[model samples]
Target chain A: MAIFVNADTKVIVQGLTGGQGKYHGLRNQAYGTQVVGGVTPGKGGTDVEGIPVFNSVAEAVAATGATASFIAVPPKAASAAILEAAAAGIGFIVCITEGIPAQDEAKVYNTLVRDYPNTRLLGPNCPGIISPGKCNIGITAGEIAELPSASGPNVGIVSRSGTLTYQALYELKQRGIGVSTCVGIGGDPVPGTNFIDCLKEFQADPETHAIIMIGEIGGSAEEEAAEFIKANVTKPMSAYIAGVTAPEGKKMGHAGAITSGGKGTAQGKMDALRAAGVKVGLNPTEAGDLMAEIVATLK
Target chain B: MDLFEYQGKQYFARYDIPVSPGDVAYTVDEAVAAAEMAGYPVVVKAQVQVGGRGKAGGIKLADNADEVRLHAGNILGMDIKGHLVKRVWVEHASDISKEYYASYSLDRAAKKHLLMLSAEGGVEIETVAVENPDAIVLLHIDPVDGISLDVARDAAVRAKIDAEAVEGVADMLVKLYRCFTEGDCDLAEINPLILRPDGGVHALDAKVSLDNNAGFRHPEWEAFRATEELDEREQLARTHDLQYIGLDGTVGIIANGAGLAMSTLDVVNQVGGTAANFLDIGGGANADMMAAALGVINFDENVKSIFINIFGGITRGEEVAKGIVEAMGRVELRAPIVIRLDGTNAEQGREILANAGIPESKLTSKPTMLEAARAAVALANGN
Candidate 1:
C-alpha cells in the first residue's frame, strides 16, 4: 500500500563489493527489503550478506528478477553504473553516491529521459527511499521510521536534506505518525527526482492521507512545488524550509542550498507555500507536529 | 568554485574559445608591464567573484601606462559588493560592434542542461528575463544528444542575433557547450560575446563556475584553490577538511548535516542568540572530526558559547558523545558548550557523557534542540 516501494519490489545492489554498498545493503535487507542480489564488476560468483553477486546489472537482473537497483559506487563510476542499470531495464534506481560531477549527472539524466524512459532515478547524493514496514532502499536508517500502523501509513514525506529528513521522520514517528513512503531527493544542483514529482505520487496514493515536505534554501524548486501544489495536490500538506536565518549567497553546505542573486530565500519559499494554503513550520519539530495535527484531524 | 574573469578566460582559451588576450596583475608595476605587453588601450578589470564590478568602478579603460597604474592601484584593493579585488586582469580591449550573451547551465526543475542566449547582453540576465523575456532564447539541451550545429543555429536566430553574426555566434555556442560539459562547469557564461567590426566574435567576459564534485577528474583545479582568499577561521577549517562558514555571531554552532547545521543557526536565532559560524562535521562524528571542528570554533574570538547538536541516523550518538569528550581534551576552549544528543543510541551517548566526569560549567547536555538552544543562548549572553 506504500507509494514507490513495497514488499514485492525486488532490489539489487550495484556496488555490493564496496564498503558502503555492502553495509547499507545488509541494513536494507534487515529492514525487510528484498535484497535479492548484487552487481559487481569482475566478482561474479561471490556473495555479500548471503546475496549472490553478478558481474553486471544484466546478470543480476536475469538471475534474481530484480526490478530496482541501489547504486553505491564512487563518484567517478556512478554515472556509468546508472547507465548500466538503466540499460539492464531496472525500473527504479537510487544513487547514494555524493560528490558526483554535475556533468556526469546531466549525462545520466539525459540518457534516462531519452533512452530509458521507464527508469526512475532517485538521487546522486541522497539517502534514498523508505516505505515503513515494507521495504527500505539506499541509506535512510530503518530504525527511525515507525512500523506500519493498522490503519496503514498515512503521511508521505519528501525532503531535499538527508539529516532533516531523518529528524522529521523521527519526530512524526514519536508522535504516532507513520509514513507511507519517504523519499530523499538529495541536495544537489540537479537531482533525478524533485518535490513535485514525489508530490504527484503522494497525491495519487490512497494510503497517504497527509504529506510532509522538508526543503532547504536553494533554487526555485520549493516555489515551483508550491505552484504545483496549488494546481494539483488536494491532500493536507505541511512543510518546513531550512536556512531561514542563513545569509544570502553563502552555500549552507548543500550544493543546491545557495541563495543566488537574492532569490531562493527561506522566507520566499515559506511565503509561496503559505500562499498556496500549505501550513509552513518554522523548524523541523514544528513541521512534524503540524503534520501530526493534520493526521490526527484525518482520524 | 567560481572562477575569476581572468581564470575563466584561461579555461576558455584551453577550449580554443576566442578571448581578448589578457594577463593578470597584482600590483601597479605588473599592471603597467601587462598593459605594455598587451598594447595600449587595455582594460583594467578588477578580479572579483561578485557581480556589478563595472558599476562599482572595478573596471576602467586605460589608454596609457599612467592610466593603467592609476586604475590598477585603485582597483587592486577595491571592495566590490563585499568581495575584495586582489588582482586586475589587463587585456587588450576589443572593438564591439554588438554585444550578445550565451551560457550553459543546469535547469534543476527540468533535470536537463539549459542553454540561454540573448542579443541583449552586457546587463544582468535576470533583469532581461524579467523585463524583455522574449529577448532571451532559453533552450533545454538533452544531455545525451548535446548541442548540435542546427540547434545552436536555431537558438541564435531565435535570440534575434544579427544575421551576419549568427554563424559565428552559433559556432561559439557549440564550443561553449563543449566547455560546459567537458570543462565540468556548473555555469559557463559569456556576458558580452562581442561581434567585432572586423567580422569576428570573441568572448569579452567569462564567468565559469566549475563543479567541485568533479575535482577528481581535474587535478589542475588545485591551482584555483591556491588563489582562493579565505578568512582566518575559514582557512583553518579548510585545512582540517571541515565544512565551516565563519559568521559574526557569538554562539559557535556545530551540527551533523548541512540541513541540521542551518536549522541549528535558525534555532539559535529563534532563542535570541546569534550563531558565530556554521559547521557540519558530516556523517562521521569521530574523535578527529570533533576535535578539528572544536579547534576551528575555539579559534574564533567572537564565540561566547558552542552548541553541538547531533541527531545520529547512520552516525551513532554514543560514538559522537565519545568523540566530543575526547575532542574536549584535545583543545583548550574559551567558551562553554551545550550539547543536544538525540536519535540512535542517544541514551547510551548521554550516559557516556555523564560518566566522563567533565565539569558541568564547561560541558553540559540538554534533552532536546529547543532546550539546548535556550541553554546555549543564555550561556552566550553570560546569564
Candidate 2:
C-alpha cells in the first residue's frame, strides 16, 4: 500500500472560502477525494460546492471523521491551522502556501514532532503527494500523467519542487511513462519530510519499481538521502539535479534554492548521488528514459 | 526582509521591550533637531539595514548639536554594504558598563527555534565565536514547550553573565520569545544588551526580520517597509509583479520559468559572462510583462545585452514574442536583445519575433539551456 494519501484518505479543506481554496477543493472532490468538510471562520454556516463548512477544524473533524487536511490558508494562519488540525487528531496535514517565515516553519515542524508524534506533515509550500489513478492531496498538474503502460507501471518521482515536478512529469509522459506516485516534499529551507523520508516510502512500495529524484541547487538533503538509498533502498533509482548553474551567494529561484554559502551546490548533490551508485540523469528530459533503461536492465 | 535599526527598535518598543528613545530623520537639520531633543551625548546612527555599522563609521557619538550635524552630514550620503545611508537615527546614548547579547530565530538546519546568548556581544558575535568559541551560548528551544525560564537561565550561565543578571536576562528572554513568535519574525536580535551603571538592561541594538508569508496578518508593517531604499529598476519590477534581482553583469536575463531562469544563470557563468539580473515573469509573462522585464534590465547601467529564455508550458511563446515586440515599441532598447523560445507554439513564436525585423541569429528558436546561454554570452561579449 502507498504511504500518505491514497484511495481511502478522507480530506478536509482549510480556508475553503478563498478563491484558490475553493478551486482546488472542488477539483479534489471531483477526483473522488472524500472532501467531507471545510473551515472558514465567518462563513461557517455556508457550504462550498456541497461540502459542509465549520468554524474550526476540530468541529469539522467531530462531524466528519476526516483523516487528512489540505491547508490553503495564508502563511500567518497556516501554522495555527496545522496546530488546529493536529489538535483535532487529523493524522496528516498538507500545507500549500509558500513564503512562510523560517522561524514560524521551525516552530510548526518542532511542534509536530514533539506535541503530535503520530501526525504526519507533508508540506508548508509543497504541491503535496499524489497517488496516481487515485487521489491528489496537494496542488500538482494532474494532466501531465500518461495512461498506464501495457506491461507494467514503473516510475516513482520524489521532488523538492512542485512546478518542476509538473515539468518533469510532462517530459516523462512524452515518452509514454507513468508514475506510481509523485511526491513534492517542498523546497523550504526546512521541509516536513527530507529526501530520505520520501525515498524510504518509495522503496517500500512494491508497485514503484524505479524512482526518479528531482532535486534543486541547494541543501545537503539529496546527498544525505543518497547514502540512505544505497544502504536501505533496493529499487533502481535515477536523479536529475536542477539549478546546476546557480550563482554563488544568491537565492536564484526559490527562497530555499540559495545554498546560503555554497553548501548544497548542484554538482555536490549530483556527485554524491552518482557515487552512491544511483544513475544521475544530466537533465529532466533524460531522467525518465534513464530510469526506464535501468528498469529494463534490472529485469 | 531585513528591517533598519530604527524600524527594528520601533518593533521592539511595540512589544514592550525596553528600547532606547530614538527618532529617525532624513535631513541634516532634522537630525540636529532630533539630537537636541534627545539631549547631549546622543548617538547618531546611519539608517542602513546591514550590520557592522559601528565599524563602518555609520554609528557615531555626538557630544553636542554641532557634532550631531557633522555626523549626520557625513552619514547621510555614506555607503554601507551596498546600501546608501539617506537618513540618521538620533537616540539617547546610554552609559553601558557591560554588554551581552540575546537573539531568537529559527535555526533552519536544525529545524528548531534557536536562542543565542553571548557575554561578548558589543562586537560581531560571529567573529567572537571564530576567535573565542566559548564566548557564545546557543539553545535549541523545542517548538512545543517554547523558550522557558529554565532554558534562558541555563543559556545565561553558559554565556558567562553574572548571577544577578541571570533572572533579569531570563525575564527579558521570555518577553523576547513572545516578541519573536508573535511578531512573525525570522530573527529578533538584541546585540549589546547593555547592563547600565544604574543596574538595568537595555536593548542597545535591535535586528528584526518579519516573515513576508505572515504579512497577511500584519497589515501595519506595510508602512514600516522602506521602499525608497530599493533600486529604481527593482522598484519598477515590484510594481509590475515581477521577481527581479539586479546583478553586476552585462547580459540582462528574462526567462519564463524560475527554474530555467536560474539554470540560465549557471550557463552564463559557465560561458564566462556574468548575469546582469534575474527576471522571472512566471507563467503569466505576456507582451506587457516582457516589456516590464526588458525595461527593468534596460534601467540597469551595467546591462549591455538582453537575453530572453522561455520554455513555454502554461506561458505561450508567441504571446511572449508579441510582448517583447510591444515593449520594444515603447521603451528604447539601450542594448540588443537575444530571444530563445521553446515548447508550446515555440516555432510560431520565433517566426513572430523574426518577422518583426530582429536578426535571425538574435532570435534563437532553440530548446537547450546550454545553447541559448553560449549564444547570449557570445553576443554580449561581442566575441
Q: Which structure among the candidates has the greatest lDDT?
A: 1
Model 1: CAPRI class: medium
Give lDDT per model, in order: 0.90, 0.79
Model 2 C-alpha lDDT per residue in residues B1-383, reported as the tens digit of each score: 67888888888887788988779999999998898788778999998877778899998999988898889999999999988898889999999888998898776667878888998888877788789888888888877678788888888988898777777788889889888888888789999887877778879888887766567778878877644366788888988978887777889998865666775675677678889888888754677888788888888887777878776644677889898888778878777777667655677788888799866644554555556677778878988
Question: Alpha carbon lDDT of residue A27, candidate 2?
Answer: 72
Q: How far out, in Å, is residue B168 in model 1?
A: 1.6
lDDT of 1 by residue, A265-294 (tens): 999999999999899999888888888788
Collision pairs in model 2:
A245-B266, B287-B323
Question: Backbone clashes per model, in order?
Answer: 0, 2
**What's the TM for model 1?**
0.96
Lowest lDDT 10-mer window, candidate 1 chain B? B282-291
- Model 1 per-residue lDDT tens digits across residues B232-308: 99999999888899999999998988999999999999989999999998765676788788889999999999999
Using all chains and alpha carbons, the TM-scores for the candidates as numbered come to 0.96, 0.82
**For model 1, which pairs clash?**
none
Question: TM-score winner among the candidates?
Answer: 1
